[model samples]
Target: MAILPKLGRAIYVLLGGILFTHLGSYMLLPFFAIILSTEKGLSLGSTGLVLGAGSIAFLTGSLLGGFLSDRFGRRLTMVSGLLIRGAGLLGFIWGATFPALFLTNLVAGVGGGIYAPGAKAGIAALASQGTKTTAFSYRGVAANIGVTMGPLIGTYLHTRSSTLLFGGAAVVYFVLAVSHLLLLERDCIGEDCPKVDRQGIRQIFTDRPFLYFSFVTIFVWALFTQFALSLPLRAAQIESARNIGLIFTASAVLVILLQGTVTRFFTKYLHPLGTMAAGIVLIGTGLGSVALSTSFWHLVASAVVITLGQMFVMPTSDAIVADLAKPEQIGSYFGVAAFVFGAGEAIGNIAGGQLMERAVAIDYLPLPWLLYGALGLLLGGAYYLLRLWQPLAKPLAPVMEERTENNPSPFRPKQKT
Candidate 1:
């Protein structure tokens, strides 16, 4: 195979891995609460608590997994997570009770958390210089494709039996795990990988630019999570699960179609900071329009707009992390990114629930939508300001030869931050 074809093949494996992972996860996610409430005989409040536990576990796992990925290897960490997650899914299918469900969900969440940093770091490690944004864009494409397919398939299976749906999802994860084991290269984990001690780890938390970036991204993620939390409530006019599915599918389709072109356009026409800021602005505008969506088609239009914004934001944010991190610390940086997102989702869920509840009680369905839209705009301004105020970390030099075979230090002196 020619070099480009080889590169494409490698990228495809990575993208396929991500696609299957997301599809499997999404397959179960959208209807999980409903399953708990109806079939599992849990109260809605109890369902929230169970899911919250999973979120907490995910956060904990993300932090720890990052450290391990840097220490042992990304491939090891990622594969272990996938295997654990697959087992968890099977356990969930067999357990048939609240405690079992909760524990299994928590296990799966932890596995997902562990898998995330390593997966993202792998992308950074594999991508060539100057193509990091475009490379990450493909990840977005894969994710959108998975998100589009997973729920539809899950819903179809769900009609037959929840067990079958969950089983199918488990099988998907198992296949993904096998693919990663066979296809993913081990070269990214170099020999002589430097270990970050407690103090060094503390330094990562204290790093101003990274800290700022992570904090800003929290709001961005919170905004994104609103699609799951608040939009459904607003679109209550369309109670058909199929219509809801269509709304989500439309968003993913837009992302699948446009992420690469959007990323490339932003790369060429806009500064990195400007690109991110513009995306945030679009997110806000798209969300603000949700106030006007009183029907299914209106909701679909809003979803498309929101997804367009997402196409711009997701890859750019990821590429920014790639540029900021040192090669070995890529996993840790992505870990922090994942942590921020998880935290955002947790917080957003609670706050959005409150907002929706209060609005419903007051007969003000649009209130939460308005608030979320305003928050997105504020986040956009924050991103712009952060770009101006914080000095971006310089990109690392190309990878050095592996030191594991014999050499002591794989890298030269650290580049000044």
Candidate 2:
């Protein structure tokens, strides 16, 4: 315990560093379909299919990682995941076709997923008095930055060579694995980790708030998944790849700047339920606006609006799970939520590929239609979650109290940014 706080800030930075690598590796994915379709005798849909399979595998691994990390401890879960992920990256280099891609991506997803719960819970475990929100916020900032940089890295690599990109990613994962072994290696879960008795899928199913937030995550991802799949298509149709990229950059910047303060303010002032509602409403409004977007600027405006919502809701949703969880089952709770979103995102991309793009220079309007449908669901689900939240006891000091109780060692790794 004495040595725990000694290297606290350093560990936090390291955790953030690895997360950036994780997101960086896949930055080329949005371009994968376009890159490989011509060379591999694969269609755009085939690229989407392989990527989608990886998402599904990731979702599964997230659930598994969350549950197991609670029991196995963060050090073991994270290290094991890093090693296996390295292996998967090797497979990616050796196996380049659609089937090989799908298989390799699956391994990467699982390895990545297993790391999520441990990373998140581990960070929270380190929070001291009046600073847990700040701690998590810092973690989130690191994650967002990593996620932001990943696309740029991926883009650069794609411009060079696909094989080089995969090979480089594999090396990064290997380096990350070694770094984890060398630094901040904790053998057990933090003293403050949630303790559960026979935690199971059934327990997660019974947690209504968890379920509701999970639903919200799904809709939000499904709605935004367009930028990765359809936005470029739409842009290409309008001959505005630069415009589309700019739109995405603007959104990412907004999120990176405001997310921390937004999350902290809402958590400090509002109920988690209300924060969740605000998120859905803002995202819905943004998505709704996208349907009406005829100009690139309109789409950019929607991105700004929706990202603000994401800033508030996504972190609050995680905190709410932390608030409502039975200490022992925290990992399982978060894992399930991640899995739900992972699965939804997987479906969203694969479906978007088919629904949004045309192969023979044909265009489909499914992008806007799907966005509209997702927006509606977000609105409806927010209402339902709100109603359920009404009868629940609202606490004021879980954040503060948690900080007081867990001070001196909140160096745990958090989930994706």
Number of the predicted model whose TM-score against the real structure is largest: 1
Candidate 2's C-alpha runs over 4 A off are 1-7, 14-18, 34-46, 96-99, 128-132, 189-201, 226-239, 347-397, 400-417
Q: What is the lDDT for 332 in model 1?
A: 86
User: In terms of TM-score, how similar is model 1 to the real structure?
Assistant: 0.87
The digit string of per-residue lDDT tens for model 1 on 1-417 reads 342222355567777889999899888887889988998888888788788877888898888788778887887788888888888888866776778888988898888888888888888878775677778888988888898888889889899998998889888878888888788776445465566666777778887778888888888888888887677777773454345766777778888777766875666555466667888778777878888876777877888778888888888888888777767677888888889988888787878889889987998778888887788788878877765673652222221122112223323354488
Tell me each candidate's RMSD, in Å, in order: 7.4, 7.5
**How well does each candidate superpose onto the true structure, as a TM-score?**
0.87, 0.78
Please write out the lDDT profile of model 2 over residues 1-417, one tens digit for every residue. Answer: 341223276447455645655475557555666755765566778877776777777788888898777777766787787777767867865675788878888998788888777676665555543554555555555666766777788888878887777777777767776776677666466565444456455777876655655665676566556556666666665546676767766776776787666865665555556666677667667765655667777677777877787776666655655665656666777687677766666666777677654432354443565455466455656655554564333442455445434442234344478
What is residue 237's positional error in candidate 1, in angstroms?
5.5
* Residue 85 in model 1: lDDT: 81
